[model samples]
Target chain A: MKENIFPAIRLTVICLLFFSGIYTLIVWGVAQFSTNAGKGEIIKQDNKIYYANVGQKFTNDNYFYSRPSAVAYNAAGAGGSNKGPSNPDYLKDVQARIDTFLVHNPGINKSDIPSDLVTASGSGLDPHISVQAANVQVKRIAKIRGIAEGNLQQLIISNTEKPLLGFLGTERINLLKLNIALDNLK
Target chain B: MNTEITGIILMYAAVVAMAIPLGKYIGKVFSNEKTWLDKIFNPADKVFFKLSGINPLKEMNWKQHLVALLTINLIWFLLCMFVLMNMSWLPLNPDSNASMSADLAFNTSISFISNTNLQHYSGETGMSYLGQLVVMLFQFISAGCGIAIAAVVFFAMKETTAGKLGNFYFLFVRSCTRILFPIALVVSILLLFNGVPMTFDGKDPITNLQGDTVQISRGPVAAFVAIKQIGTNGGGFFGPNSAHPLENPSYFTNIIETISLFLIPIAMVFALGYVLKRRKLAWTIFSVMTIGFLLLLIPTVINEMNGNPAIAKMGIAQPMGSMEGKEVRFGSAASAYWAINTTVTSNGSVNAMHDSLTPLSGMNALLGMMVNCFYGGVGVGFLNFYIFIILAVFISGLMVGRTPEFLGKKIEAREMKIAMIIALLHPLLILAGTAIASYLYAHSPVAYAGWLNNPGYHGFSEMLYEFTSSSANNGSGFEGLGDNTPFWNIACGIVMLLARFLPIIGPVSIAGILANKKYIPESAGTLKTDTATFGLMVFAVIAIVAALSFFPALVLGPIAEYFSIY
Candidate 1:
């Protein structure tokens, strides 16, 4: 055991240097060529900067509300509600979200609301919502912004992201980008 | 089929296709054979040995290997504790995160060094950049350590006479440099392009369209995430793990990360086959593991996609299935696939929250850890399966009234005793740990009221899953449990230590003993271990020993919850 100790300590130090120092430096160097130079992808809109991938809270009636967040879309410390499927209090929260969505968009029934819009995501900072989730909110946004419902529908269609390779994921729209596009519309 | 279903199928295909060749490469690497990467890594490895003053040529028996493994792990544990506890004042702490409490540090350090990675603290606010890097170092070495010990077992199995197993440092260094490093490099770059942050810069505060100011946590995520996936460490750069958008940016990245979880584990099985010159044996083992894996996976995918029936009772459409704690980009199918894969491999990184999964799916995840041998964690995974193999060989030999011999080495009473103890240890730790926590909670509900986020059956599952994860060295959790308190921290730390070391020691000791025994040539009456019948025997042993032991505890938790919900 004594004989193994020195070598163990030595090997660990060398490993710390190689893996923690050298390997990390190599990856960090390569990231210099990536989006936003690997600080994270950023969007500059209306003289304000935003993380393109991180979700933002958009509760205003004029904007397309992002999915409910457990951390209130706090990117600094991301997490989910971690609510179990059968938790009565959690179910109450989901039902409350449904009722609120119905109240905000009078014409749309509760059955039309997508679960993504009501339930909190794992990361709390999920950037995208399903296309169905986006479509259900068209009436609320159109009325609040005094824009034609067709143009809002057109905007949803144009912004909707197709699955990878046309058949590898769900169709979804980034709510932050979609909301930014809404603000830009005449 | 819908895109979600197709996506999972393609990911599985990609992993198996890639693992076959990677397995061969790994086999060659451990055997000291010339490989394509040897020109580059040979000199690099020389520098490491020289710096460490370790003579890679000095051979060690299994006892020596364990000594080296445990000693180095202890050093790492101390170093990790120091960094985690002092990172607030350490260099490179751009986030200004506070130092960890002693109990939290104990849990975190043990968690990473054991390769279980059951995080008691959220990464974004809880860890500094320095702390993250130190944790990342453990991610590489702990996995390398597991792989190296496995290489020793492989060597022992392949030996025809009593001889020293290869040097532990040589195998361990080679694992990190030759195997884990290069793959992590490629995966890191892929993640970088897909927008996982890799800078040393601090958090970026931004204003959204709604004019709300939010602080976006950014750091050396790309480098951290790559090793986290490849090593089966499953520690995350952020609290949400792969479910976080930045950690796993898109579906394409999701496919890349998910494939990585299964890559080294499946490859290790094939590596065993290559080293032993027994392709049929490898295939039999792979088939049995795959069958066990699929049994857990299929039900989970169905349940997660079917959505929560309780949620369905409310008037809303769940076309995307159980979206609570799941992202839209990956959807329910891929998330369910990941849940089972992560648990089965002991990778433990979740793309979706496990606590939010439907009850049966949650049970399947628990069962994956309980059955813990299906494609298992890096090198240690195969070691866990080795115990089952030993037990199977012994039991079958007893049934057929023949002496038990594995690859011509007799498995006597000593090996059987060791295997039985190790096999029983898993259930013992999980059941006993959960019992204590449950007793504490039941006796004083108000005192421990904060312990659970959910009430009743599902809450009971949170405690059960924690110990099962710790015992299996699989780090993914139900996450709803308030686990940072001293009770949980100390309890799980000890469990992880015992689980990680004892399992490695048991298998290696057995293999070392077997390698030293007199070789007996295969006779007409020798039990054919490589055959399908033998595979069935091994499967039955695993089912009876690992799975059945956890049945009552599971019934009380997930099964009861499943019936109550549906």
Candidate 2:
């Protein structure tokens, strides 16, 4: 045991330097050539900047809402509501969200609302919503903006990202980009 | 087929495909056979040994290996504790995050060093850059330690006479340099290209289109996440793990990270086959583990894709399935697939919140940890499965009225005692720990109100899952459990320590003892361990042991919740 201790200590020190210092430096150096220089992907529009991947709050009637955020889309920290399926209080919260969605879009029935629209996401900063989530909100956005609903539908279709290789992952739309496209419409 | 199902199929295909070749390479590294990358790593490993003033070729018995593993792990624990508690004033803490409380430090340190990675604190707020780096160090070494010990056991299995196993330091260094480092580098670069951050800068404050000012946390996440998945450490750079947008970024990055979770563990099985010169044995073991994994996985995917029944009653279409605590990009199918993969392997890094999974799906996650040997965590995973193999061998031998021998060595009462104790220890720790917590929660519901996020059956599950994860050294949590308190921190700390070392000690000791015994060559009377019949026996042993012990707890938690909701 005593003989092993010094070797263990020496090895630990060397490993700490190799893994923490050198390996991290290599990754950091390579990241300098990556997108946005590894500061994360960012987008600038009309003097406002947004993280291309980070979800944002979109409660206004003029924009498509991202999924509900447990941390209110606070990027400083990420979390989920962690509410179990059978929890009455969590179900109540979902019910409230559904009622609110119905209130916003008068013609859209409750069944038309996708579950993603009412439920909070795991990361609280999920940038994308299912295509169906964006589609359901087009009516409210069109009615408020006084744009033809057909144009908004076209925007949704264009912004919709197909599943990777058309077979791996889900079809979704980036809420931040879609809303930016909404404002860019002439 | 739907994209979600197709996505899962592709992910599994990619993992198995990668694991086969990687497993062969790992086998070569341990066997000291020449490999393509040996030129680069051989000299690099020599530096590590010289710096440590140790000879790489020095022979170590099983006891020496355990001592070395534990001592270094202890040092790592102290180093991690110091960094975490003092990072507020330490260099490179750009976020200006405060230091952790003593109890939290204890939990975090033990959690990482044991390879559990059960986080009591959120990374973005609780950890500074320096702290993240230190934890990342553990992510590499702890995993290397596990892989090294597994190599030791492999050596023990191959020897026909009492002899020293290979040096622990040599195997450990080689594991980090030749295997973990190269893989992590490739994965990290891929993540960086996909927008996972790799910077030492402070948070980027950005104003969204809504005119809301949000401080976007960014750091060396790509590197951290790469090792986290590859090592099966599962400690995230952020609290939400892979679900965090900046941490995972896109579906492509998601596929990469998910594949990493299965890579080394599945490879280790093949490595065992390679080292033992028993390819059929490896396939048999792989089949057994894959069977268990699919059993848990298929149900979880189906349940998650079915969405929540209670929400369905409220008249909403769940075209995307259950979305609470899940991301739209990965969808329910991928998230559920990741959930089962993470648990079964003891990877414990969630792409979605396990707490919010449907009751049956959540139960499957728990069962994965409860069974705890389906693929499992890197090197230690095989150690857990080895215990089952011994138990099965003993029981089947008794049933057939023959003395048990495995791999040409006799299995006697000493080995059976160790195997039984180690197998039973998992349940004992989980059950006892949960029992104590339940008593506390029930005895003073008002005082411990914050202990549970949901009431009734699901709440019981949160407690059960926590202890099971700790005992299994699987760190994914039912995060709803407000578990940052002193009770949880200290309780889980001790549990993680005991669970991590004891299981390793049990298996290595058994193998070491058996290796020293006289080599009894296989005869007509000897049982064939590599046969499909033996594989079935092992599977039956795991099912009976894990299911019988954990069923009552499951009844109270997810099963009750399932019936109540549906």
Candidate 3:
């Protein structure tokens, strides 16, 4: 028992030093080659900085819709609402989101609202919306922005992120990028 | 789009391509053969052995190996628990996080030691830098311990008429230095270069476009995330886990993280072939596991891609499938694939919320953990599958009127009893734990704080998923359970320990005892496990055991939730 206990404890201390101290420093050194040096990808547009990797809330109808966030797109405290589907509060929140969307897009049916638009993402700040989510709001955004629906559709098609390997994930659009494009539309 | 496909193809190609050689390299490492890295790591190995008083050349029998494995694990557990409970005074604690409650510390220590990494506390705010390092250190050692024990099992399975398996301490050290360290270092650098933060500083404050200030938690995340996936210890550096922008910044990083989860587990399968000089048998087992993995993966992907029918009824089109809990970068397909991959291998990191998944997809994840043998954790996966193979051989032996013999060892009551108990123990712990939790939730008002956040079927599913994940030693949870309470912290701690150690002991003991038996030449009538028929039979046995044990729980939870959702 002593042989086992003493050696195990000694080896563990050595491993702890190597993996936690030395190995982490090595990884930190390699992070120097990465974009932003692991400080996060920051995009400066019109002198305002935006984290290109994080979800940004865009509530105005003239722009493409962003996914709902339980944390209000707070990158500092990223998380889902941790609410179960049947939780009345969560269900009410979704219902309220559905109501708000219907009021903005009068022609859209309640059943036609994508769940992504109404429900908060697990990472409270999901930057992308399903291709269907973008499409459902296309009518509302075109009417408000006065851009031709055809041109908007073209932009959506161009921005669609295909599943990796055409087999890994579903197609979706980065709402931040799409809204930025919407503001730039001539 | 085409480039995305290319990336996926390249990643899969890379894992198999690299794993084949990695498997052979691992084989050589354990056999004490001369290798290139031995010059660097050999001296370190001797230092380790000397400090621990382990004789590298002295082989231990199965019992001694088990004793060594358990004692060392306990030592690490004690060390980790001490650090966790006393992190307030520990150095490098920039955040000055307080010590964890005794219950949480016990749960966390056991979780990491068992290679489960089931985190009940949110990491960013809950743990200081000192605590993070403590957790990261345990990740490496625990994963190494698993591989070491697995090496012993492989040795026991192969060496006929030898009473001794290899040295546990030697295998543990070699596993870390040769296999886990190199792969983890490479992965860490890859992730660091892909934008995962690797700083030692405290949380950074950033003001967003909305004019709201937020504190961005930064740490040695790249180092932790690398081994978290590579070692199959899926605890996150942050609360949202890999879904965080800094943890998994881009599509490329997501692919890397997902691939890392399966890489070592898959390599271990190939290593079995190389070590035993039985490539056919290894490939057959690999096929059985992969087929099971793919079967679950495809349905989960399709269900998630189909989106939720309840939301569909609200007149919203689900053209991009289900995106409820998934990130846009990951998409429904990738997130579903991750769900299946992580659960199948005991890698519990999540890029999306399992709780938000559609009913059938949720069930697919549950079933993967329930079976708990597909691909599996680094070294322990094959150990679990070996149990089913032994049972299959025993049952088939009875039908053919031949005494069951595995690798020249006669199967007897003692061996069968251990295997049965080990196999039976998994479901017993899972179901019993869930039953107790459910009862407490109903009868005891004191147990009702944050226990079930959702009522009805989804609520039941959350409780059920927790126990299944714990009992399988796959620590990903539904994220909806308020599991930080004393009731949960202690219950799951006990479950994770028993679930992890018992399965390991059962297989290694059987193999160790068998290795000592007298050799008998193979006859024509002897069962060939490498053949397709026998592989299918083993698969059937796994499916049957899983089905018989978990069907009621599944029906009451995910299946019921599915019907309710539709």
Candidate 4:
């Protein structure tokens, strides 16, 4: 009985770990099966959608406008521009993005611009924006609607997140939700 | 950076003060089993005793409890060994990958279970969601196991009149249910509040400006980071590690991360002294570990603060000394803190890129890993430190011509042999491993080119540091070594196992032996372990051991690196 007790305890611990390992394998298989789908599925933001190519037009009017992405798919495959932060090529890219922003955002000036809107996030496909980024476009959107800028500001205020539960991500507007809200207003 | 003054000061004050009180409270609570907490934990206590076939109702001499606990931990080790071998096929893999190769798998299992978590492959790239769950889940349990063991030992030794080695089951259950769990809950809620994503979904792809769809990584990251910090298991869910913006997010989170790295370690040290009536004993041990911590920390801080001179000459600001491998919000001080904390505790999680650290700064980070103190990680550090303390007790015993005794337990020849083996194994790996790596280069082609081209003092140092850190379970690397290959991987694997189990087994056996002996009352002639003089001796012993084992290697590695730049 004494000998059995020690062996039994050892066997239980070993068996528990052995099963946990097997369970982990099963869990890995399941997570992998679900993993290959894509980020939107992983994050559960199915409402968020975009074209795979830059030239593809986004004609949805009810969705909020996202910053134009210059990232391209090519025969060469996927990657960032790889331009150093201070490179002229990078600067020129930024200039071109700003021009596009200005054309899309009529009557907006340099003073009202949020740098993040013009600049790409590190991963280059950010779906959210700094509250400041949303606000810069707020004035233009309000003017287009012939509404009070105050109401537009109110719209942004209501949309701003509290950050991760209370302390994680920076305060920002969800680009998808804002566009949907715009349609609701009409 | 300037605007967060009130917050930073408050954080600093809170960490320093709250750390002391929290530590003292844990110490007092675990001193004996009289609190309300005992009632709640008693059930688990009873269960553990039954599982071990021990009578919870029957009092055990310390030896019996030690054997039961040791046997349980050994079973856990084997379980990890088995689980890691097959974790790749498991679930939650946003990225489907297979098991780490045998040696690396073995090392990684030991790493996390030991509260080391010194990972070779990036989490996002290498592990499935299930692997993280199974492996990291054990991190929490093993971490709790270590803390409980430490508390049990402290409670055992603290009983001056009659040694009441508190129930191992009670200690294990309470430490997990009470301490680790509650802290993890608070931190997770706070992190979730801060906008760190907490969803459990598969990968989500978004079309990009470049006209290609990009797959974004996602999972139960809040759960991962919470335990990573609380358990002092620092592996991140993503490849870029904690540096990934999604994983860490912002400045407030950054500070919280820093505090998480140091909290339990600091508390454990405080508990050590409080266990003995001489509160100073803990401080003495703290002083040795702190000195080792600061020796590396200050240099890394200064070098990083100085900025790369080349970057400065090229008209770049170098971003205030944290330009390389660091986020802008954290700046230099916090990065320095992470580098130091992980190395001292052997946690191996990094907030910045070690490769980009100024040469001297990087060396300090690497060296700190070699000197991983009793603060190394959850259950492991105290075991390592106590071994040295035993050594110090014996060595001093020799000086005075008395038999060595610690905490009313006499240190014998067998115990000394175990301590010597534990101390020597680390150095042996450093010297022997580097010699072979350097020697094999003449016949092999892999490591011959990159950093080893010159093959002088500098190349040797990098190899030496690699083995030293790996073998010691101190996970930081020189980042210069070509360690991603089979030769280095397999070599590091052997070193990792030897450095890991040899250190653990010796002390546990010693603990078992000590537990069996009848307690000897303190005498006037017995050398007090809790004194400043002894603290100094402890520091010297630790320093001398690190020096004796790896100093020659350090001379070749960092010393040569310094000469290379000059």
Of the true interface contacts, what fraction does each candidate have?
0.91, 0.92, 0.53, 0.03
Fraction of the native A-B contacts that model 1 recovers: 0.91
Sort by DockQ, best first: what order? 2, 1, 3, 4
**Cα deviation of B138 in candidate 4 (Å)?**
1.9
lDDT of 1 by residue, B1-566 (tens): 79999999999999999999999999999989999998899899999999889899998988999999999999999999999999999899888899999999999999999999999999999999999999999999999999999999999998473767899999999999999999999999999999889998898877767877788888999999999999999999999999999999899999999998899999999999998889899999999999999999999999999899988999799999999999988999999999999999999999999999999999999999998889999999999999999999999989989998898889999999999999999999999999999999999999999999999899999999999999999999999999999999999999999999999999999999999898888889888889999999999999988657989999899999999989
Model 4 per-residue lDDT tens digits across residues B240-304: 45655456656677677767767787788776666666577777777777677767766776676
lDDT of 1 at B316: 90
User: For candidate 3 chain A, which ten residues in a row score worst on lDDT?
Assistant: A82-91
Please, what is the TM-score per model? Answer: 0.99, 0.99, 0.94, 0.72
Whose DockQ is greatest here? 2
Scored against the true structure, residue B242 in model 2 reaches a CA lDDT of: 95
In angstroms, how far off is A43's CA in candidate 2? 1.0
Candidate 4 chain A, poorest ten consecutive residues by summed lDDT: A73-82
What number of backbone clashes does candidate 1 have, counting pairs of residues 3 or more apart or in separate chains? 0
Q: Candidate 2: where is the Cα deviation over 4 Å?
A: B159-161
Model 3, runs deviating above 4 Å: A45-48, A60-63, A82-92, A107-113, A131-172, A177-186, B1-14, B50-53, B445-449
Candidates 1 and 3 compared: the better one by DockQ is 1
Model 1: per-residue Cα lDDT over A1-186, one tens digit each = 999899899999999999999999999889888878998898899778888888899888888888899999879899999999999999999999889888889989888888999999999999999989888988888888899999999999999999999989788898888988998997
- CAPRI-style class, candidate 3: acceptable
Weakest lDDT window of 10 consecutive positions for candidate 2 chain B: B158-167
What's the iRMSD of model 4? 9.4
* Candidate 4 TM-score to native: 0.72
